[model samples]
Target chain A: MAEHDSGGWTLERTIPSETAIGSELVSGLLAAMQEYAWPAAELFHVQLAYEEAIVNAIRHGNEFAADKTVQVRLSCTADEVRIEIADMGPGFDPDSLPDPRAEDRLEVPGGRGVMLIHELMSEVTYHPPGNRVTMIKRRPPSP
Target chain B: MAGFERLVVVDKEDISVVRFVDRKIIDASEIEQLGAELLSLVDIQQRKRLLLNFEGVEFLSSAALNKLITLHTRVKRAGGTVRICNLHPQIREVFAITRLDRMFEIASSESAGLAMF
Candidate 1:
């Protein structure tokens, strides 16, 4: 996809709810971040957020249904990076997710993905039903 | 000694120093395999101490974090211990954000991790 509204580059893909396909999409997004010279720390944040979103889409949202697919749109610019992911499966409420950091839930392995995404991204929002998520990380001002 | 596709395990005294094969541990199947291999050290081989050395890991998702937490749980249940060391700053930030840094015993170097045992 052509860069939208002065973003240096944009990518849009509808990938199957499969791990291998999701990994390729993540690699492409990271490459764009590298090309834009995002700092190493910020790049990790983007990578973590995107990976978690895609995996959540496939595993939790789509339930790995062969018939379902995940829609992904990524835009990278000098000023900020944005990605939107949506799955076709039944959606759930994000607020219902227990805090993985809570003493009672700290040992639970699966609930940390959404927590980490919110922690690392500059901004995160879940649309109605919570099957779709939008995350943005603005570039930090140069020292 | 069992063959390992995702880990390079070295014995240092009573601890097994484990290093990951991939720089970014985000792949699903790989993470599953990694979790299995790590648990094998405690379950099958009966290792009591594990020190995961994160010298080369640059990026990892929460899936990978889940594996580490599982490993920690299994090891502790077996009356063993898990210590992680050499995390790059960004990786360290992930643990901090998840509060896993508090859950895990983190060391600055291999020697320090070994010293914990």
Candidate 2:
């Protein structure tokens, strides 16, 4: 509930894992991030990546558990912005994910979310036990 | 973000181009909004072509890709065509993975997109 900012670094909210809360978290993060002057394209990328991660936590991690919660922590500095999305779901093997681009499996209906996340973020890592996703994006150097 | 700005251009020849003008299509909200806006481009009584310009879009989500398919189906059902152009390398990889590059007419540039009609 307490938000803090220092030297262009700020920490936002911790939200629940219900779909109803997803939009609010996204909007709040976007609003806070806008102050850091992220370019519109990168802003959108962050928004999308965050949404996908939270949705996965809500739908897959919590398995729609009404009592479950997902924590979203955002911090931004002059050089980079970092987001940590943690869920209580049973963690799965990230390596087990099939290649979404496999030539023979082109018609598959799912499995692209993580791929998109990897493409957008400067760094991505998964924490076991709680199934936390950490993503970082660096700001473009000033001209 | 530098070279292009978000530009939705509708030509009199019945083509609508929604240019991303930046690095990616990130969320379902923007994708839905784009679909809605594309629909509004035509009068209900007429059919129109659609071209999603990804010149600046470096990344794309599966949700956005699904929305594109939905848009294509809707426009096709209405007797129009849907084309895609200027896919960034990463985005092109996505389309290839989903095999959507085969589903849609993809061109290298705006002119190529126009020529598809």
Candidate 3:
């Protein structure tokens, strides 16, 4: 819990595309959330959204290039957890992606991450050229 | 049988039952491994029905769902069927939100899921 001072911390790192950093970042973020003292269910939601963000940045955004770098920013505060991951690839129109929820696309295995990100997080906005995403999850009220 | 560290398998009659062993989040390679094991059960062993039991699983990533979709396609081609049961609440919500619930036959219990096949 003493990973940082009582004050919140903000960090930025250019993630190596070769590294699949979702699990690690989520674990670290969960650890970092100790100060906020979120409930288990709320914490799980944050973890899921963070996983999708990091995966999208590394997988689709950077195309898993060893040399390409994915920029990651993590900020933890008492009220919310915010993350931004940007990749160095040609951005695609999010609208062009097929909706996984559509009956025709249900048989297919993709198009879920973005939807999950938006649903799990309190706020999710794509940055133009569409290569970067900012996601936020507000801490649940104390019971 | 011991299925790589994250998965457990039990043969019950004609049903090939697969269970996850822990609460940890499964990554991509592990997902592929699970998919391969399922494919072997359906393809090599000619098992026509699969029951994926998730009572022990604490979380299911999109990667894990992808594995299920892959298995579904493979089994469907062989005239076999894949059914899932005991999905964790969050996982169940994921399947629902993604509308995968509409395509995959999901049941509440292992017996119910197995009966579907």
Clashes of each: 0, 1, 0
In order of DockQ, best first, we have: 1, 3, 2
Q: What lDDT tens digits, residue by residue, belong to model 1 across residues B1-117? A: 369999999998777999999998877889999989988888898998889999988888788888889988998898888999999899888889889988898999989988887
Query: Model 2: runs farther than 4 Å from truth?
Result: A2-4, B1-61, B67-82, B85-103, B107-114
Candidate with more favorable, higher DockQ: 1 or 2: 1
Off by over 4 Å in 3: A1-3, A141-143, B1-6, B115-117
Q: What is the DockQ of candidate 2?
A: 0.18
Residue B79: error of model 3 in Å? 1.9
- Top candidate on DockQ is 1
| Model 2: how far residue B13 lies from native, Å | 9.9
Q: Enumerate the candidates' DockQ scores in order.
A: 0.82, 0.18, 0.63
TM-score of chain B of each: 0.96, 0.80, 0.86
Candidate 2 docking class: incorrect
- Local error of candidate 2 at A90, Å? 0.3
Ten contiguous residues with the weakest lDDT in model 2 chain A: A1-10
Model 2: per-residue lDDT, tens digit, B1-117?
112234456563666666764465554456666556555544352546878777766665676676666666667777787888888765676576466887788999989998998
For model 2 the local lDDT of residue A81 reads 74
Expressed as tens digits, the lDDT of each residue in A65-107 for candidate 3 is 8889888778787888888888898876777777787767777
**Model 2's interface RMSD:** 4.5
